[model samples]
Target: MPLSDLRFLALNAWLKRIFNADVTPTLISGDASFRRYFRVQHKDISYIVMDSPPELIKVLPFVNLANAYSDKGVDVPQVIEVNAEDGFLLLSDLGDIQLLSVLNSDNVYAYYRDALRLLDKVSLVIDNGESGLPLYDAAFVQLELDIFSDWLIKRHLVIELDEKTQNMLKTAFSFLIENVEAQPKVGMHRDYHSRNLMLQNEQLKVIDFQDAVLGPVTYDAVSLLRDCYVRWPDALVEQLMTQHFEQVKSSGQLDRGVSIATYTRWFDLMGLQRHIKAAGIFSRLKYRDDKPAYMADIPLTLEYIRDISARYPELEIFSAWIADSIIPAVEAKL
Candidate 1:
């Protein structure tokens, strides 16, 4: 029998044991990680069964954060059952509608306002004691910056960086890291974007939050406003950014003295760091994991890098290089 079939049989047996009846789960989807999801209906209610391979991904962090965040009034899926020893979890289904699917020019501002309100609750959640979220410190920031250089520029694109080019990237990365250091740290949903947000019962529920971290206050905000998968007009994005700035300030998450100009710089640079990492991650997913669909998103990531980097004097050369060299390479290759 195929390994997948054997795994399915084992999962079925495990579910049967829990319910004391025959239970079959239909595959839903696999995410970017090493986990698979299945939809199971029992007692006329739908639940999501997360099948995270023990050897590949740990189940405890997700369980820990889900409970912690839910207690703080965040609309995360409730955990119903756990078989952590076997890397399986049964959770309340948040449904199939992603926030991205429903967003339009007409409703984006209103919808995004609600999403930003949810962030107030999310920012309140800090440490989870023994299962504390990791710090997104200098080392962490540098490592993520390296992924862009290693995967996208070197490995996938095969661009050998000479001495001057290497120095340019090093300086540019240092400036980005300084921007990260300038902001107040908060609980950040590292992948808090439209795709991971579910729209059920007219509310937004967060998912794919296992990688939450203690990072810049602007991280999640930039992730939502300057999303990788979708682009909003500059005016609309700026409006939402200012809205978030005021919301955070009023809630005391941000200092009242922080100027909108300073906050805008923080948001813009934080987004640049995220897009840099994402472009490389997309390449790594394509080449290492054989998931080529993510490659389609790389161009937008590059465009974001180009546009955002050009806005600052510090990153002018780096931005020019991207526009002059990197974008052409990517265009030709893709």
Candidate 2:
């Protein structure tokens, strides 16, 4: 990964060339995406260079969205320089304040409330009657649900549901989709979890927001509370959810068209769908992608699916089947 032969080196060089800034490059940590990053230091000056290989991930969308957020007074990483052709960017360092490093059981409320306030602010800033991001529409949701079927059911289980079971699944999915479609949509940070929230200067700073989109109002909230990397107690989640519903309502996004009970139901069902999607995605990551850390989260996610499915008697037969047969079998090992 030397500068001369690196795939992203040229792109990094091109961005540096714009500022005529000489840099001493050092590799930096990156998350699960195909993107990588580096820290460059030269003449006592420091900047973070995001090395997103162009062939794998586009730069314009991230750049444009970050710019849009910044323009709206949100604290996004400043784009000091960029080379769109090669997918490299020199950005202002947000500093060493990842939320995970500072979080604990006691301070979750304070930090979460702060995060919620920021979310509310962003919702306010972007409510210009149009969302610039792509909608996580019906098609996108269907694709996600299919991942659950393909990876979790077919691949992991090594079996197919019978016609009766399959029909029940289809019915459950129809309810899920109908519930998802009925909710009000907004610009959502698709992966707004603890790992993505940074703590720059004791204030929560959002990152990994490039995947932001127009999605369900509950998507990010559930992503936060019922995180893949962390789990909170059900009581706490419910309390915070009540607080969040109030915030959303006061923010003027609530139209009387969707009843509160209906919205709550949508939120529950949508969470069930997302948990299933996450379980499948995590399982696939371990089994197919050679990333094994995710396998540990699968059981908890499956349990969530069982718990939620039972909460509604309309889903009793299906939930009972999953809880009694599928989940117990899978839970023993996965």
Candidate 3:
């Protein structure tokens, strides 16, 4: 039998032993990482089964973070069974309506308010300074920033950066990295966006949080506000920012004497770094991972970079290069 078939059979055998019932598992989704998820039906109940090939993906991080979030009263999946060797875990299903499909001008206010509340609640435990989640520090930030130049610029764009352009990127990246590292660090979801959140049991539940990191407080907020998947109006985003800042302040999470203006700047700059990283990753996913559909998001991500860069004088050269050179090249290819 093929390896995949063997793995499937083993997964079923394990499920049967755990539930004491014959179960048929249906594929649900796979992410950028090495893990795949399935929904298993056993005795009229639905459970999410995570299949992480132990050789390719480490299951311990997900397990540890899941326990930490669960203890903090966050709405996250409850672990049912874990097998580290085989890399299978049974979990409670958080239902299907993702925050992405339901968000609109009509109801975004209420939903975002709930999101900020959850963020504030998370603040309580994020700084335990002991969870041992990997630090998302300057090195990680630099690695992500380099992806744009390595994958997107070289492989996808098919253009070599001139010396001047290369220097501009170096300067731009250094500025972004410095700004990110200067912020208050905390336990961050790392990809807290609409799609990773589900409206389950009339409550907002977070999912896909295994890569939680000790990073900037604004990283997740930027992921949500300047989401690549969905766009929100600037006015509304600013309002939500105010709401989040107020909640953080009330929770004693905000730094003393940090004005809302400064916080907003941090949020915007953090988003620029993330957007740049995402642009490269999306391109890499298309070329290397055979996920071409991700290229659809590149234009929006670039738009974010262009808009944000235009606001900072230091990024003017980089911004001009993007508009004069990169944008046209990307448009021609697309």
Candidate 4:
């Protein structure tokens, strides 16, 4: 149903009263998430209307953050009118080009350097106690990891693992949790990557930031560099990572001689957890929503977790178990 319907009758009526035209909702990109965005054109003026089903989605946090960032002069979408009670929000349309699509090996280094500059700007604003987002604490990190057990292991994999393997898995998660929890928490985009970044007017306009949290600083870097949607060569990833480290150091985001080894460990482990979560999420989408396209990407996500986890000698015991037991079993089934 479009916004020109009974559900949005009050909203449409309100939009007419406010914006003064016949507004028709046009669907924009739909993602795995419950929220939806639509374009509304009245005369030559255009806007985006976010339709978030109230029962399944919450809007206040995103609203608050958007306003905060807006106040701080960040180029986020401007909120036009909001029906908080019914989850309808009218916003300024940023445009069609996503930074993800514009990015390539040719000028990736330059573009990413600018992107890091933006992150640095965000850090400065956020660090001044302006943004009051929650941290991805030990509990949350552990909970994210549990998505694998609940969604993948039990739900998708549908296995009754023997006690020994179960214990080993538990130990693996424990190790992962300890390392992940130890990193200094910073404001995370939560979904920071090329896809959420739009190239509007040759500027990187960030979106999909409703779930931002304070997490390991390296998580965003890894998410941006080793994006699940796009792959880059290892050398390029390292180059970008190195550039980020240098810039953050100059920007005072890092202290001199912070353990590079530990940061790499955090990035690798975080990728493992995120990749595992994504694989199961993709499977769930296929089985539950009949969206089989997601299933096509599961193999790459699994390979990422497997390949990265295997390289660490310390992670060998755990990776071998996942490789030999968990993934193979899930792959055969899902």
- Which model scores highest in TM-score? 1
In candidate 4, which residue ranges exceed 4 Å CA deviation?
2-11, 124-131, 286-292, 325-334
Q: Write the per-residue lDDT of candidate 1 for residues 130-225, one digit (tens) a residue.
A: 656899999999999999999999988899999999999999999999999999998988999999999999989999988889999999999999
Error of 4 at 92 (Å): 1.0
Best by lDDT: 1
Computed on alpha carbons, the lDDT of every model, listed in order, comes to 0.91, 0.76, 0.85, 0.74
Model 2, residue 137: what's the lDDT?
82
lDDT tens digits, residue span 103-193, model 2: 7889988888777767765553342224566778878878888887888778877767889988888888778887778778877878877
Ranking by TM-score: 1, 3, 4, 2
Candidate 2 error regions (>4 Å): 2-5, 15-24, 124-131, 256-260, 287-289, 325-334
Clashing pairs in 4: none
Give per-residue CA lDDT, model 4, range 141-185, as digits (tens): 777777666766677677777888778777777777777677766
What is the alpha-carbon lDDT for the whole of candidate 4? 0.74
| Alpha-carbon shift of residue 269 in model 1 (angstroms) | 0.3
- TM-score list, all predictions: 0.97, 0.87, 0.95, 0.89
Total backbone collisions, model 3: 0
Looking at candidate 1, the ten consecutive residues that score lowest on lDDT are 124-133
